[model samples]
Target: MEGRVLITGVAGFIGFHLARRLLADGWTVLGIDNLNDYYDPGLKKDRLAQLEGHPAFQFQKIDLADRSGMEALFAGPYFDVVIHLAAQAGVRYSLQAPHSYVDSNITGLLHILEGCRAQKTAHLLFASSSSVYGANSHLPYSVHDPVDHPVSLYAATKRAGELMAHSYAHLYGIPCTGLRFFTVYGPWGRPDMAYFSFTRKILAGEAIPVFNHGKMQRDFTYIDDIIEGVTRLIPKIPNAQAAWPQDPAASAAPFRIYNIGNHTPVALTDFIGTLESCLGEKAQIEWLPMQDGDVVATYADVAELQEAVAFAPDTSLQDGLQQFVDWYRRYYG
Candidate 1:
């Protein structure tokens, strides 16, 4: 084994992909997930099926908020890298299920930090979201900008996780990397996402909801690109850059944040058009007002990520969506 890596949400869209990538890279991966029926348990199971074929991959059905379970997992062996990707991930869903976000995103993350503190793990990389930039009116979201304002509970909790990790990194010297992922989409993608749902509707000849009156834009990043960014980041561990009098936000502990996103922002209408092209069918559009807990646009400034990892998510929307459409048709059939 190159290194022992633990990935929470191993059955998740990104986590599953990350697990496969790590296994191929000769790393022993220990994955954990509650396998809750958030989107589709069958999808999670299918993803798990793929990883289970690899000898280097081991999985445990456990919740991150389960303190005893987390402690037990950490008490056994020290993981070289802990990729915390598990969270109740939905901006709109947050309105209805706020507690789940708190339980999984906040309390669950506490357990992860505690485990790392006990083990003093080499590096910790966790998922953050572009939603953290909440109503900032910033053209392209940057890591240097302050994320004090958050619109949704999901975003708030993600930002909270970053703060918690920063504290852990500062106190326990755990090298932490906070990844602010943009609108991620592609194969084995979350069914709840607009892209996936839209594809399904378009296939079924139903109307796809165009939110924000079809004026919204999203920096849709492909799954492979996100995995590439994350894979590159795993090895570039953080080092505390602060002195006592320095700003904690800047020099805070061994903490750093990166915007892993496609620099291109695609309009919702154009995105749907491309998906239609890929599926070779026209979509019935249901233009509606923007729902709460949703942003009008998200563009990522990945200069920092490029500088650190020499990479950024550049997969074009047309290419990414077509790949997704292909996967959706194959997977559903």
Candidate 2:
């Protein structure tokens, strides 16, 4: 192994793929997840099963909120990098379960920050979301845009994670990078995501609910592209700026935020059409009014990401959705 790394949320979709990739890249990966029943633990276990036999991978069932466990893990070995991807991850669910967001997103992130601060990790890259764009009417969301007005509690907490990370980077001089991921989807995806649920409903010959009356748009980034962006960013540590922007995204500290997204906005109807084409079945869409805490469109301005890593998510929707549909059929059939 070239270096030791810690990945939280290892059983989750992005984390699983990240762990596999890092192991393949000759990194010693220590992965941990609470494995809560947020979705289905079976899916989580199945994701873990893929990495259990890997010689460079180690697994532990530790919650990010667990202070002692996190401290002990950090004390064991100095991680060359730490990727924090665990959180309460739904915009709608926060309405019913707000406390879960606080516990996992806010409090859990505190523990991770403390661990990294103590361990003196070289680079601490954590997951943020494009939802942080909140009620901004901007067409293409940028890292330089003001994110003070978040609509959903989920968005609030993600922004809070960024703030907390920045504080740590400033106080402790840690190299921190916050990735604002857009609507990520691919094989072994989250069951709660619209694309995943839509696939299930379509497979069951039922009408899939089209929120915002099929008028919404999203920068749906593929999971492979998301992981590739992150992988390519591991070695590109941000230096403390001499003249920091007034924007919270960049400061004199080694804290930087990047929007890792497809940058192309697809209308909901067009997305459904692509999925139907891939599945060879027409989707029965029941259009409905826009849901609360949902935006009409999300387009990313990944200029900073491209400038830093020489990469941006560019996977075509047709190609990405076809891979997803193929996996969905094989996984569910």
Candidate 3:
């Protein structure tokens, strides 16, 4: 189970946690990140700083869209597994910077696919998002659902990445797994995420914006749960099925998708209250109309994930937020 693995967004929230976990499990990891300032490069650097000294961990500064750089990288080493997590992440940012999504999410993914095709990589696990369930009114989004209507450019790019991976898997026989992560939040999380920003605003006695007039719900999967699901999936390579079931999640080719989510949707108001309790403070609410490119709720149907890996996210929001609050106090102080 332990082997040399290449993790593309080594400085990212999930990628950082995954790398640390793999390194601890005795895997030699080559982690790469461009360290972009999409949010705060300083936080990304601090994440990297923690992983720099590990004997089994090595890092390279490379942007995924850099085709020549990626070519040079893949030429040097034969990565048994490539965990592609680098992308232009942010649902709202895509509205203002649409081209960046194409550049990073679409083109960047193409480079990764090409490298994997050339290397004939044993397994390629790439990050997708729950945003792909856009315009689908299903209570618990399932991989079997057709993701044709993406409300945001970010969601479109994610769906495009999934299709691209499927094509590569079919043609090149490269085992590819797409992870559809839900509202992932925890310590060392993205600054753009609601929970992270909420913690900061509440601590500073500022009004936190309550999107959708505080009527939205999200399946806030904790970071540890996400890592555990991904770790279990890394070794479970998909085999090409002789009988095609016409399921979007699986194919006759070596491709599969799974929703790694908590499966428990929490109201935005309730989530904020939990955070307030964790921080020992009250939140000033700024109620606002529903933002464009935003969903009213996200609930994951993790039946396939549980059946495949015999595991699903089970972390409580209260405990997860408490851990994040403790980390925030120590890190910010």
Candidate 4:
């Protein structure tokens, strides 16, 4: 509790909430984000405003790819841990702009690894995604499962990050925790996400695109559940364990990966129904074929996450969707 933590991507949905939670728990937090216009900058600023006047919080407008800036940040303070949530995110956007993923997810992650190695940070917790379990036919995607078949550029880059982290962990003995998050949604969520956009379209009497003809399903983990799992794992950094094998997925080094997701995967149509129920308006339907780089479904096997962190996402889809709808009305109305 008496330690300073550095969180990259502080302007992002998950990062903002994580930093806020840490600050409230009496942790000194240094938050850094480029505040890119991937979505509305206004929402990002609003999130930052929530942390204003919180004595334990500090903010810096810095790009993760800026190696010098990253080095300066790590050198300035002997941080107890680094929670990296910054990345050029989005599956569809990656198809259009693949270089952005390379610059941010690949280069940016390398910079972070360098910083952690030099500073000897006790632990480094970074974000991964369920998308990495690409093209897998297996149900309830597990951390132990091979994730080499990444279907999207974004997902491939994220998997690359895990490999990069492993190399650094093996060479320098830096403790690294990689969390593969499921479909995270809640208040202050990203506008590019399906739930947020669907809500807006539905409320405005516009048609919401039901991709794959609404046949898809997702393990929609709530934002609060993600925070709970992450915070709980902060104290459980993987160290040199005799039980670990040399498998690339499971590390002999002080590194680990966990799939943090809601075990329940709701069908796309049902999820929309839940949203409609929450907003008191039926969505105008625009059934469409699946877009490029889109998958049919995603489900997480969270037994490892639950066993290791003593946490699992328990928020029901209705409850989480209702919270999002409520926030949307107040924020956009």
Candidate 5:
């Protein structure tokens, strides 16, 4: 199952871990990232530094929005698999910077689709989000659920990406798999995430914003679990179904979508309490109304994922937070 794989956003949390795993598994990885300062570029650089010395690993500074650059990249090497994880990621930021979502999530994905179409890649695995299950009142979001009502521009763009990928899969016969990741958190995670920021504020004795009056819940999947689900799926390329059941998650073409999540929802208050225990410090909670583009809760129905890959995220919040806290202390110290 090891071969040349092109991983977009290799410096990001999940991408960095996936690259390290694939490289250790004897896969030649050419990872590309824009190294944008959406968060701290220093963190991205440090993540890249960990993989730079690997013999089978190569790094390139290429933005997904760059058409010619992506064209040139695909023109050079015949990638057996393309893992598209690069995107302008943030739920609230999309409110202020709507255009960035269209550029990275929409246009950026188009360039990827075109490249995959031309290269005829074996499997094209791209990152989607649980946010795509916006405006749906369903408890455990399923891939078969209708994702027509997106609460934010970010969610809309993600839904658009799924549709675009589906179109390409149907038109060009490309094997496409869309992964809807739940609240992913761990060491070397995005600073924009609430858990990461909350840790910083709690340590500084600052009031951490508790949105939705701490009533919200999230299916916080650990980074290692996310990587494991993705790794198992890389070789499970979808085959064209002979008879389509008109399901949104599957198609007659070589296309499918799966929810990669822990399937366990933890309340926001409970999550904060767990973090406080991990940090050995009480967080000064600043209760606030729910911000725009924020969902009340997110729970994933990972039955299909388990059925497909025989794996589901089962890491407890306590253990995962402990691992993250240990890493944070070592890295920040």
Candidate 6:
């Protein structure tokens, strides 16, 4: 944990937070991000500015799709572990730009895997998503659940990344951990996410979209909880288990996945109500049908994560929303 750690998507919402936490914990971090216009590049740069002040943190602006750049990075001798978080992220955007998912999520991930393999890294922890449980109405989604039918191309690519990581772990004996994150929101959150956009629209006195008639639920995990889980799991890499489930979701290799979530699904209306309370404003609701590539709900079962890492996302909606609202007012006011 003290040695150099390579993090892709260093400027991303989760990535930036994770890097900050790691650096605070005395771990040296090497970060890289494409700074793509998928979101506001200004936000990414602002996040990078914080890391720039850390002596233990070094960052490079590089695209994950750049095979040559990734190769040169891997060719270096400093990285002891790789945490790959860069990807083209949005379920709805995947529908319009399927190739973007392929290029960033698929191609970008392959490069990371290759880099880990070549460098003989100690452990590789990559980001998966609760979206992989698409179309499955099963509550409290467990890592053991079958994720074969992803409703969105984004989800499918993420699931594919998990499988690919498992393959690398099996073939090369590389330690690999995949984190299935729930609805993550907090300070320095993604602008495209519902909570952030809803805050904007509500503050502007504009109507916010209420998908599924505002009946959906999400296990909204806080950023601190997410960072804790990721940090704790860094040292606990998976080993082959003799009693591994025959389920395709289970693997006998040195590959494992855990659902990092709050384990409490709050209704959309309730979530909005919390936001309204935090921001001291009422939102104009615009009811809408479910969009393509969107599931009605996402609930993560973090039992495996708790048993393995001894930690789970436990932050309440009100506390998380208050933190986000405070940051939003300061940043956007």
TM-score of each: 0.97, 0.98, 0.99, 0.98, 0.99, 0.98
CA lDDT of each prediction against the hidden true structure:
0.91, 0.93, 0.95, 0.92, 0.95, 0.91
Tens-place lDDT per residue, model 4, 72-94, is 88879788989999999999999
Give per-residue lDDT, candidate 2, residue 4. Answer: 92
Of models 4 and 5, which has the larger TM-score? 5
Candidate 3 is scored at a TM of: 0.99
What would you estimate as the lDDT of candidate 6? 0.91
Ten consecutive residues with minimal summed lDDT in candidate 3?
Answer: 272-281
- Backbone clashes counted, model 2: 0
lDDT tens per residue, model 5, 1-333: 889999999999899999999998899999999999999999999999999999999999999899999999999989999999999999999999999999999999999999999999999999999999999998889988889999999999999999999999999999999999999999999999999999999999999999889989999999999999999999999999999999887799999999999999999999999999999999999899999999999999998999999999999999999999999999999
Worst 10 residues of 1 by lDDT: 242-251
Candidate 2 clashes between residue pairs 3 or more apart in a chain or in different chains:
none
Report the C-alpha lDDT of model 2 over 1-333, residue by residue, as the tens digit. Answer: 269999999999999999999999999999999999989999999999999999989999998878888888888978999999999999999999999999999999999999888888899999999999999998799998899999999999999999999989889999999999999999999999999999889988999999878988999999999999999888888889989767666799998999999999999999999988898888888989989999999999999999998998999999998999889888878
Put down candidate 6 lDDT per residue, 151-176, tens digits, no spaces.
99999999999989999999998899
Identify the superior model by lDDT, candidate 2 or candidate 3: 3
Give candidate 4's error at residue 101 in angstroms: 0.7
Regions of model 3 farther than 4 Å from truth: none
lDDT of 1 by residue, 120-161 (tens): 899999999999999788788888788899999999999999
Instruction: Write down the TM-score for model 4.
Output: 0.98
lDDT of 3 by residue, 185-258 (tens): 99999999999988888889999999889999999999999999999999999999999988787799999999
